[model samples]
Target: MSINFEALDLRAFLAVAEAGSFRAAADALALSQPALSRRIQRLEGLVGGPLLERTTRRVALTALGRELMPLVRRLLDEADSGLFGLRGAAGRGARVTLACVPTAAFYFLPAVIARFTEQLPEVRFRILDLSATEGLDAVSRGEADFGINFLGASDAAVSFDPLLEDPFVLACRRDHPLAAQARVDWADLQPYRLVTVGRESGNRILLETALARENVRMRWFYEVTHLSTSLGLVEAGLGVSVLPRLATPQGEHPIIVTRPITPRVTRTIGIVARRGRPLAPAAQRFRELLIETWADKVLADKVSVDRPRP
Candidate 1:
């Protein structure tokens, strides 16, 4: 169904959501309380549901409103950024939002953000550090301007620009038996306790499928929801973990070391953005900077391998 609503209506909803009171929202929007109510009513009608639940004291977002907040924020932000032919863009917030897998966010974004901030100190960032599936969702739905993700190269809705080929490696404490080896084979891990992420994780699925093809099966002695958790377990000497090399700390960690595993399993880390979508000027600049930052012969050569990522 085609639905049309004015920007003022969205502003009315946002003001109420933020203030949690229609009176305060109306005051902030410079509209009479009744006027604000009508705009909200009109918006609710168009949406076919109430966006808020109003009590005498405060207002709360409905389930649908909770889900709509990110998309709405993005729409208003884009409009403010001169994406919708609206003027008065001087009022734009100058904020850039990107969804990223926690691993990539931890590994890459700090340096990239630091560099971007050096150039554009006035700009701000909102990072949605989600999983691969969630990151892809955010980029595809425009809730994020783009994403740093390991999935979505074949997805038609977004463009995935490869940054590196991150192979799965064995993560263990420096004192662990496997750490003595220059490199470990998948069979080498069979004798040790294995720490892994939960099966629901995208990385787990990818790794499991790839290892199965190599006739290597992993049995998890401990399963956690995050790769970082697995790494923590490994560092504590509970068991070793199999994870992307990028998920490990760069350089040396006093307790932890990663060993290359053969035959290799890899994931392609990259930038993901909605196809044909033009990012706001600041976002476009940051995206370019991120690509340029990773465009290094040394870094690429270090991660590049013959293994095909799932």
Candidate 2:
């Protein structure tokens, strides 16, 4: 049979059942005797059985009430335990840890981290800056809460949530022949020496994978393992490097500029967390903030590029 008693009713019944004196129970519950009686009466109505035998001097539990007492106590105990766990899990002093590729760690996450820390001053972060492959491994192995990386090969151990599409751009010195153009094609960049990341880099893999789909390949005169090195080479008039628009600095650079590649190629960046596993409250909050920050960045970049030039 289904019972409709509230927790308050259960508590009130338990209080009176234990004390065996309505007056004493009332005092313990900080309730008037009549109010306590009313609560027991409501509980009886829902339980469809009288739970207490009350008299002028003594109170006792009926057989049904005695049978239910242990069950009620266990329920209360479990409820308290659950609430205690929830409170501790979301506490302000908790540490949030996650992983992401170096490119994201460098260009995207710092601003998001600054804003998140402002909201949760006591929260600590253990941000693992690794390659996309390593980031995925960290989350899968439970070493990290989650990761951010370009969308590529599926994994049964991890899940991805696409946040934004980062397009490849041509990074070149301001004085380069094609730097003045708003956009340049892959073929246009072929005439000049090209700098690219090493094959070990996830960025390089993503670029090569994209180019292979179109049956296109470019000769790389200079190959570097770091984006900073690629930028340095571009600044020194070595050659232009193709990179995600997000990798380039937001504002004007005195010597180097990034122009979008024509027939725009892009990579999908997203969140990767362990399959069927939920993140801690702090990690979840940081994930939401990252999404909001990315959305703001996308809008701001669109406005900056679309606004009328003076």
Candidate 3:
């Protein structure tokens, strides 16, 4: 046997593996269901064992399938980067769309975008600075190639690669009475009027769920839609806000300061991509850069935070 398999065969396998649904993978690739099945079958036969365990309700990768996934991704990545798989050199200067929550978009993305454009100068970017829920929808619907989000870790349609744990912290003016404490408790915030997002916001939901167990009732003095708005209100001495550490000012602000609030409520921030879809070469490269850059930075920040005081 020549042992030859086309790129499409590998792609078919990759799609179904990511999707966990033959129909979804087929639709993504614009192939008929039976045709997609035949492709998967042909690829499986060439590989010398059953790659996928498929039934009516679910489709999962077998042991061999798990082992082969990285190899398949690498092969496809190489093809997409070059002119062979793409439609000529036009793809060399493509637009990469990314969805991110507002805070991440503002604080994290500028550095990554600067680093990415240094190498791929012609590559453009479309940043969808959406809310957490909207960001997940963008990536799932393929509007964005990827997202930096704190939600979607459990979403069935997307894969989440966690980058960091962003803890909720108390944001208040430096002169506030609670700011004198090294760390504040939920009960301590009871007397002060709280600035918070609406009930429907993901952050609010995560917060309310956690605080419920502690019987910590917050007094909402002002409710804003965006985290930034809450911060702005805090800066103006309106009210204190509890928000993710990432959303807080990093260094000494003239008025605002952040302190860890107990019990800690943290969100796992990560990269989210649609299951079973392939990113374009430019998008793929940018995603890789973003992960590498942020992962190392977060690890360094963690180590510094963990280092004992003198």
User: lDDT per residue, candidate 3, 87-150, as tens digits?
Assistant: 5343456898999998888877888889988887888889998989989999998999999888
Q: What is the C-alpha RMSD, rounded to one decimal, of candidate 2?
A: 9.2
lDDT of each: 0.86, 0.81, 0.86
For model 1, residues 97-210, the per-residue Cα lDDT tens digits are: 999998888877889889988877777899999999999999999999999998887787888778888889999998998899999999999999999998889899889989
lDDT against true structure, model 1: 0.86
Candidate 2 lDDT, 1-310, residue by residue in tens:
6766677777788888888877777888899989988998898888789888767876788998988799889887888788877866695688877788777777778889899888877789888988777788788899998888874336656777666678899999988999778888888987889998888888888888888887778889999877888999999998889988777877989999888887778877777778778888888898899888886555223321111224
| TM-score-best of 2 and 3 | 2
Q: How far is candidate 1 from the true structure (C-alpha RMSD, Å)?
A: 18.1
Give per-model CA RMSD: 18.1, 9.2, 17.0
For candidate 3, the 10 contiguous residues with the lowest summed lDDT are: 300-309
> What does candidate 1 score on TM?
0.66
